[model samples]
Target chain A: MKRIIEVKNLYFGYEKNLVLEDVNLDIFEKDFLLIIGPNGGGKTTLLKLILGILKPWKGEINFYDDNISKKIGYVPQFSSFNKNFPISVFNMVLMGTIDSKNFIKKYKKEEIEKTKEILDKLDLYYIKDENINSLSGGLLQRVLIARSLVADPKVLLLDEPTASIDITSQLNLRDFLLELNKKITIVVVTHDPTSFAQIYDHIACVNRRLFYHGRGELDAQLLEKVYGCPVELLGHGIPHTLLKEHI
Target chain B: MLEVLSYKFMQNALMAAFLASIVCGIIGPFIVTRRLVFISGGISHISFGGLGIAYWLGINPLYGATAFSLAAATWIGFSKQDKMSESDLIIGILWAFGMAIGIIFIHLTPGYAPNLMTFLFGNILTVPRFDIFIISILVLVITLSVLIFYKGFVSVALDEEYSKARKLPVRSLNIGLLILIALSIVTLIQVVGIILVIALLTIPVAVAKEFSIHFKKIILISILFGISICLLGLFISYYIEFPSGASIVIIGSILLGVVKGVKKILKMKLNLDETIN
Candidate 1:
């Protein structure tokens, strides 16, 4: 597989304290890489650095000879969206195709057609003209995903893709992602290991540092190491941990 | 109507209202949608410092106000630290300082304040021909800029981070918006005065937002609302001997209440249908 992103000795901080330290990783093209970690583990920070939303204090991130910030499609956490905002699904998706230099021109016919196709592919064609504020959480998530796809990026970086949605929507999103991984690189930051186990080619457990980066199933031993507890895998691929001993 | 048009000052006031409303209508949606109403208020109040400085230096207060407000706008736009609350604190301090300076200049001016109440409460009847010309040109510039940069502006207004990820110039666009707001503040001062300017800038846009979903339509409706309110206010002030600025604002508030009330009724009806079915 071809290497699409390479990060070497990346370091970043907000103030006196460091958030991410001496991080190094390589992402291959068309690879579904799942980054798992607890809250405040710097996973979102790492994604921000890759998207060029924040600059690394030291080291560099290179994307296939171009700046990673320019080409990569980023789906931020849904919490960033204001529920009362009055944007439409079509306009929201059209935002993905916008760049700094082309501020003057309106959306072209080809771009509009492409947005329609992507919305249709995501089963969101019916909600194209609906105000984003009116949609349910699941439908909004699908719209955001469609927006990310409209950019036609080589890599799709999702920050907590299924954080706050229904189970059906979560499964639907996972299935859609599984299919999407066949065409482009997918990097998802999520805590749910069960649903993502089969889809991801590699899992990187992050906790202030990268604990492990390897392939294969997420066995109990690895979960224990990452979560500092014994994990039990229930039916339907849900993870339940036994804390009687700790208590 | 013909007799009213015969007076140059009345004609000038009408022209100023038309020009000011055009700029206000175009920029008003951005102010409301981006939740920058407070920032615009901060800028309007801060322009007082420029007014003071101009009075003290024997220069045009308009120039002073523009310079001060634009400077404050630039500072607010460029200071992108994580804590936005801290930035707002800084804006508050600047706003107070500007007001203080304006008062001091007024005190130092040799004349009997040159009818300061007119500038404070807006005497549209006294608007000059030159002010009308300036307002017209400004409206033209503002409208053209909005037309050319509609997509960028919309993207940034909708979501700044997403726009930045697409490599759009989010910082520059923000600064541009602030400058536009400063200009709008200066243009509006003659019609509504600084104290009531935000009401004129925000109320029509707020009403239009409840009725329209598209940006272009909102702009059109806001312009219509602003012009109609101004004309009605002028007529009422002329016949009833009332304050023009207050009259305009009162009419605008009533219109806003009616629109919001109607929208609520329609939404409730739709919800009733959904529940019943």
Candidate 2:
């Protein structure tokens, strides 16, 4: 497989506090990589660094042999989007296809037809014209995922893709992502292990540094090492215990 | 009504209200949805310094106000490195500094400035034919641009990070939005004045929001609401000898209250029905 992203000794910080330290990783084309860790483990920070939203204080991130400043599709945490924002589902997804380099270029007919096909695959064609504010959380998540997919990115980064939804929606999103992983290199920052159990080919645990990189089912010992505690996995695909106590 | 139309000044004021409200209507929803009311308010107030400088320099105050406000808008748009609160503080400082500069410019300008009150309180009644023509063309341009770039604007306003990730030129679009807002503020200053400009920008959109679920519909309704309030305010001022800007703001406030009250009552009734059913 072709190498899509290469991160070398990545160092980043917000003001005085250092967030990421000497991180090195290589993401191959169409790799389903899950980044899991405790809260404030700099998972989102790393994702931002890879997406070129924030420049690293040290080290470098390269996409397709180029500097990471090149654009990549990003599915941000649901909390970041204002629910009251007046936008339709179709328009939201259409945004993914917009070329920043050519601002004045209009969407071609072929692109619209392709977007419809993606929306249909996501089972979101019915809500194409629906107000985004009125959609259910599950529907909105699918729309966001579709939005990212429409960009046809070389690498797709999702920050906690299933953080605040119910069990069924979480499972549905997991299945959807698994299907998506077949096409693009997927980097998802998640806290829930079960949500990524069947989908992820490798797990990258981050706590200001890369702690582990391995294949197959997640090992509790490795998670404990990264989290610095005897963590317990709980029901409904969530991390219930951190440091042997409920958290 | 016929007599009102007979006067050219009245005709110009009416045309200005129509054109300005159209601009406000189209752009207002974006501002309200993005929760950039404070920023817009800051820009409008700061433009006073530009207006004052123009008066001091014996030039067209509109040109100075537009230039100063556009500069402030650009600064606000590009200063993303700072936290939101810190950025807001910067905008606030500019706002006050702009006003101070305007006041000093007025002080520096020689002779009695009889028409200065017109800029401060809005002289819609004395709007020149050329000013009316300029406002109409600007409103047309603004409306057309919004239509052409509706999707880009919606995405950026809704979620800028996602927009950028999708390679949507988020920064440039943001700057475009700010520039449009600066132009709107400069144009509307003649209709409602700077003091009540924010009120005009926010109130119609706020009221329309309660009634419409879609952005496009909200904009259309906001234009209707804005035009209605302006005309109502004009009539009230004509009849009761009240200040035009104050009267328009009062009309907008009343409409906002009515919309909020009606929405609350309808929501309560729906809840009651659900409980009984």
Top-lDDT candidate index: 1
Candidate 2: CAPRI quality band: acceptable
lDDT per residue as tens, model 1, B1-277: 6798888888888887787778779899899888888889889989988887887788877788889888988888888446588988888888788788889888888878874676677867777787777767777778887888888888888878777777788888888888888889888988888888999889989988887777788899999999999988888887787888889999999989998999899999999999999
The alpha-carbon lDDT assigned to residue B36 of candidate 2 equals: 86
Question: Model 2, range B64-108, lDDT digits (tens) per residue?
Answer: 988988998898888843577798888888888888898888988
Q: Which ten-residue region of model 1 chain A has the weakest summed lDDT?
A: A238-247
How do the residues A113-232 of candidate 2 rate in per-residue lDDT, one tens digit apiece? Answer: 879988999999998998887877788888988887776666778888788778899888888777777876788898776677645666777888886455634455655444433234
Clashes of each: 0, 0
Best prediction by DockQ: 1
Write down the worst ten-residue block by lDDT for model 1 chain B.
Answer: B114-123
The best candidate in terms of TM-score = 1
Chain A TM-score values for every predicted structure, listed in order: 0.85, 0.83
